[model samples]
Target chain A: MSVENFLILGLGWAGIFLPTALGAIGSIVGCARAGQAACGALLDVESGYGRLVGASALPSSQTIYGIVVTMQLNRQVSVEASPGLFALGVLVGLALLCSAVLQGSCVASAINASKSKPEVFGLAIAPAAIVEGFAVFAFIFGLIISGGIPGTLAG
Target chain B: MPTATNYYMLVASLPRMPRTFEVEQVPISRLRLQQRLEMLNEEDTTTVQQMQEFLLWDRQHPDRTDTEVLQEYEQLMQRVRNVLARKIIVYRMDVRTITCGLRRRRLGMDPPSGVGQWVQAIRENWEHPDFRLARQHPWIPLVRGYMEAHQPLQTERQLLLAIWNQWTRLADRYYFSFETILLYLARWEIVDRWTRLNESLGRQHFESLLTEALGEHARFPQ
Candidate 1:
């Protein structure tokens, strides 16, 4: 293949994979932050260890959503399609990234709050769940946007 | 991605501390706090250690002279990397200086014209109660009241609690950052100091009071 064609294909591949890459990166950071708090909460209280750990894992949902969006974006990935792929994939990935990391902070705060006031545990997690909802919005929209690109399942 | 230096785990592991003087006992035991402190990165751990050293009730260096201690503290301000730490130290200096001025005035001594940071503040506002600082620090008036009343315990509690409250505000501002951990340690030291006061020093105060009362009663003077 020509150099231009190779470059286009490479760009397309990057676009196709950006969502997963960025999402995973964000999830890794987010999970680690929340997990650290969970581990800390475990030190403070014994019985709620399971719940804290569960809450910490909430950020990981963004990564799953990113995967689904990327699967939907899978297609011929031609020069014509690469720009759209890059735009949607990167935008969705960034949204997922921010949502996951921000949710991690929220989860950490939740853990800290609930460790002291156990009654607020359920209420504390509501914010984190809301953050995940934003990521899902990006994921579903990314899938819808992917349908416009040529040779994709929707196309 | 990995929160290597962030204090989320350490802060979370520690129990929520109540207001200063609210509890006689610290929420976390020394051993447990030490274990949690081990999680701090080398640099922040050093900062915490250095700052804690300055938290001793009288803030005196037993081995070092006053000049040397001031020099050491000046060096600490330069060496500590955190802005919050520097700001806290400056705030502490102002508080300590005001307290010193209060004590010197209580003793009818002129503000010493020597190697101190706040001699100027004291000398300039020598005649003014609260040393013109009452507006900035409303507690200045209260601290002055306690000092003049010869209520050292109350004076100390007020001073320490003020410091504790300052640290609390600083911690709340930085919430999840490493600065929060630093402020947490500072506040913890205040709680520890309050609780520790009820032991040896408290007994000494009580004994002294009893002796003074007996001495007053045994006034068989010509």
Candidate 2:
């Protein structure tokens, strides 16, 4: 392949992987922090394993959303599809990244609060769920728009 | 450590027993001392004699009010607060433990939101009208006596009423759930009275109370 073809192919690959990679990174970091909070909470309280584990995993859904978007955007890589792919991939990934990390922080706080006052567990998770809603919107729109990208007929 | 001035300010804040009242000839006990202090609030003449007797019974310091007695009483009240707080913590733990066990058995996974739904149910229903009435009645003495007696897990009606009132108020203002409120009452053996009935029968009793308290058509619905 010519150098020009190689560059376009690389860009295409970047578009495919960027959002999933960034989202996974966000999920890992966010869940890790929440998991740490869960551990601390367990040391002080005798029960509530479900809330701790659930809160810690809340950010992981972003990664799945990213994967779905990535799959929806999957198609033959060519210069024609690069811009649309890049725009959707980078923007959706960024949204997932920010939302996951922030949701993780919210979950961590909820876990800590619930540890001391288990009665607040349900109310405390409301913020994280709200954050997850934003991620879902991005994922759905990304899916809707990715289908419209035009592929080149050139061989 | 507090400076001497600060210590003096703190001590000055609490009401001092009057010097004019003569100490009574009767024996002084902690319970009698508490009763005498309460009697002071009633404007009752009988309480004055008990307070004077309890205040000056000290042999080494007959004339001086053993401010130490008052200080000790304050400490006792603080201890009661501590015990109540611990009981709340343990009750929350119980909810989490139960939710966790159920989740593990049912889903083979950790609980997602702990006992959040259960907590929410308690928080929402705790303020039923019956609970409010319970709070109006003072039951601290009953609670303290039960704790002192080290009785079994049986509940007392007055104590239960008092706790339902206590926790319902907390639920109204704070994010705490019904368990925290109930456990605080239970720690003092208050809920045991309500629970003494069969579980379904107890449910019916509370359901009726909640319906009446909330004035709602279907609050705490079965």
Looking at chain B only, the TM-scores across the models are 0.82, 0.20
Query: In candidate 2, what are the lDDT values of residues A1-155, reduced to their tens digit?
Result: 88987887778778877789889999997887677666645544667677687778999999999988888777778888887888889999999999998887788768766665689889999999999999999999998888788863222
Residue A140 displacement (Å), model 2:
0.6
Off by over 4 Å in 1: B1-6, B57-65, B112-118, B199-222
Model 2 regions more than 4 Å off: A152-155, B1-222
Task: Name the weakest run of 10 consecutive residues (lDDT summed) in model 1 chain B.
Answer: B110-119
Best by lDDT: 1
Q: What is the lDDT of residue A125 in candidate 1?
A: 91
DockQ of predictions, in order shown: 0.67, 0.01
TM-score of chain B of 1: 0.82
Q: Per-residue lDDT tens digits of candidate 2, residues B1-222?
A: 321121111111122221211223212233533432341222222323332232233223535332553454344334433343444433433333333333243344533333322434433433332222223234434543444465422223444354445445553452222223222222222232233334556588888887788787755458
The candidate that wins on TM-score is 1
lDDT of 1 by residue, A29-106 (tens): 899989999998898996877889999998998888888888888888788897888888889999999999999999
